[model samples]
Target: MQRFVSERILVQVGLLIVAVALFASTFGQSFSSSDLAQSPMFFPRIILVLWIGLGVISLIQSFKSDEKTRQIASWPRIGIVLVAALIYTNLIGSEGFFIPSVGFAVISLLAFGIRNPILVLLFAVLVPGSLVLLFNHTLGMPLPTSRFSYFF
Candidate 1:
């Protein structure tokens, strides 16, 4: 039992259980009777379904493989990224989404060995700007605005 529990298969099984639980939790969500299309729960449910399917496929693939091959991740690089993310999350509310996200993107790209300044600058600007526009305008979601928002 101990050996089985420690196998790679158990990790896949755990993921499957988590996915199923996430899908199940959304079952109790109530959609609007007037417009099911515009229901708030629609997108989340779709994502949950996709997650569940992926989990099942991964579990099956795990069973098919005889040897468990795990790649060693760069812990220092990962730690730097994690710290950057934490700083971004904390600063976003106070500094607004754009600046903190741009800073995070640049730091992350640099950490991942992206040496080209032009590419990094383009990505750092475009990605966060696009997300800010998408969430704020298209989805009618409000993002944190800086005190100097008027200047931008």
Candidate 2:
């Protein structure tokens, strides 16, 4: 079987390495069983473990994936996404997460060649809307919002 050394594999490897390094760094933190939530390493360790696990799975999948199915990413689309993400970041404080996220989703989807207006509108709204509801309500984690936060 021919091995594929693509960007997908590279990303998985990079993520795995970064996760492992971060996990290792967590060992220096004070671990107190008394208050798991209060421990500095608690969230980091949890996230790192998840990241490492997912990275390994992705790396294995990448290795097993058929080379014929691999689609090369568009450099121009990537640039658009990067620029859109930067704009999204700046818009978060002023325009709020929901607005910026929807806008970003639309732009990114368009950049990646999704031309269906209905699908685009649905995805752009639903994805960010769900996230907003989940974070703002279900998890009790308030995201950045404009003055009329709930209405957004």
Candidate 3:
């Protein structure tokens, strides 16, 4: 007799609800209905609502189904993905978007098994090149020249 509700799924659903509630409570502090048509809180509140709704759906789905199955999660693979994201975030301020973005992309692809050296090199160049054009030039948020701007 297998349990219908999974402990891990329940915990995750609960955490999601808590996170959504926290976001929702902070909404009133940053935004009011009259602040603007598109206030800062508008997007966050919408996201919070969606998150809570999904959490509820997850809870219901978990309970309504039975016969739980499990698969082994490869921690090394997960760690590699997280490390890539962190590298991108950390280098974004110092190295600018170009180098860090390209490096992160290439490393991420390799972590996921893109073994061909040539293909990995192309991906590294293309990903950051696209980002530079899209965000720096097209979006007008030019990449910072150097850390000297803040260090000084």
Candidate 4:
């Protein structure tokens, strides 16, 4: 099996599993009204249904495609990124989004062999900063904010 086929099947299967789990969880929530329009589960169920549908489509497509794309992920880099992500998740709540995310971005960039200081700093700062702005300010949704980040 080609890497492309394996990766696609794995992703689609994972998506289906997760979507089913989420759909099942929606059943556990208590609804004040049983009405379709008013029930909280209504929107979630719709979204999950769509997600499951997409997963099925992707799975079917995976078998049909014979593209021999040679792109492969580096295990060492992937492991480093996974560890960084785990650490970032742990730090996000306590240390807040900006500080943890900046550190995470820098580590991720470095792990990928991005040694350019200017690009590192630019990406490390811009990505997280834009996310904070998008979530916190633009959308009126608050992400965890560091006390140190007076402006962000």
Whole-model Cα lDDT per candidate? 0.83, 0.85, 0.74, 0.86
- Count steric clashes of candidate 2: 0
Residue pairs in clash, model 4 = none
- TM-score per candidate, chains pooled: 0.50, 0.49, 0.49, 0.56
> Candidate 1: deviation at residue 62, Å?
24
| Cα TM-score of candidate 1 | 0.50
Scored against the true structure, residue 118 in model 1 reaches a CA lDDT of: 100
Give the C-alpha lDDT of model 2.
0.85
The most accurate candidate by lDDT is 4
lDDT for each residue of candidate 1 in 49-151, tens digit (9 for 90 to 100): 8888998887777666566556548877888899999999999889999999999999999989899999999999999899989999999997898777879
Q: Estimate, for each residue in 1-152, the C-alpha lDDT of model 2 and write its tens digit.
A: 33555666666788899899989998866665637788777887898899999888888877877654456477799899999999999989997888889999999999989999999999999999999899999999988987677563
Better of 3 and 4 by TM-score: 4
Q: Tell me which of candidates 1 and 4 scores higher on TM-score.
A: 4
Q: Which stretches of candidate 3 lie over 4 Å from their true place?
A: 1-10, 13-74, 133-141, 144-152
- Please, what's the RMSD in Å of model 2? 8.4
Worst 10 residues of 2 by lDDT: 1-10
* Model 2, C-alpha of 89: deviation from truth (Å): 1.6
lDDT of 4 by residue, 1-152 (tens): 56444766677788899999999999877879979899878888999999999888877777787754466578889899999999999989888998898999999999999999999999999999899889989999999866776773
Tens-digit lDDT track for model 3 on 94-137?
77667777788788888888999999999899877777678777
Best candidate per TM-score, number? 4
TM-score of 2: 0.49
